[model samples]
Target: MLAGIVSAVLAALVFGGVAAPAQADPLPQLATIGSTLYSFGDASLCAGAIDLALEAAPHHPGHVLAHVTPRGYLGGPCGNQVKLGWVGSAGLQTRDVYVYADAAPGETITTDLWVGTGPAKVMAIAWPIRSTFAEWYLLVP
Candidate 1:
């Protein structure tokens, strides 16, 4: 369940989706803002959309750009509850952020959300740290 949310966040920023609609710019295949709906169209044209949304406000919507989850690890960057947040410091708007790993409960993750770049390949960073154990997640751009 957690992994799904992280993937949804990952889908938002990666560049690879359908075509843009005739009326508006290439719509996002599945976009949102703090549970608020946005848009979606061709799966290709809007590939870089999620990245754009996160670029606008990575914290508001709680899109963890810390790291990419491993091939099979689906544990998202959240606790058992539904509250959303990040593991490291705040995200830098306008820059490219990379998903490092899964931010588990009480974990520490670090991601670079560049402060001047356009919508590109920002990833979902997830860093889950335990007393002596640690985990991570990285997104694909």
Candidate 2:
């Protein structure tokens, strides 16, 4: 009789009585908006964008330049000259910045602008020849 009771208890524990703990979905590693790619560092602000960024760079290198922007604003010309500077090295480095606005949950929008190697220069081609570029993340909040 005792053996039968012990077996029933064991079966209940192994089969279905206790509920498994719920876990949140893993954070994403990459995000892409148009031709641009966004790579995130360990201290990334948003989780969803991280996944998108990773998708953009599956086998990314150690040093990369990421530009994040909204969906419709990519075609616009630079308002002023922006210049960024950075030292190139062989170590792995990531720079993540929020562009435009904070990404709300379930809000799907093109938030990544572009990714590149080395510094970026944004030049405005006009009468006087205005040029701009900068190091680090561009158009970030």
Worst 10 residues of 1 by lDDT: 41-50
Give the C-alpha lDDT of model 2: 0.29
Model 2 compared with the native: what TM-score?
0.20
Could you give candidate 2's per-residue lDDT for residues 2-111 as a string of tens digits?
99999999998888777666432222221122232232212222222211221222234232323334222222211211112223333232333333323332222232
Candidate 2 error regions (>4 Å): 17-21, 25-141
- Model 1 C-alpha lDDT per residue in residues 56-118, reported as the tens digit of each score: 224323233332122111333322111123232334333222222232223222343332222
lDDT of every model, 2 decimals: 0.27, 0.29
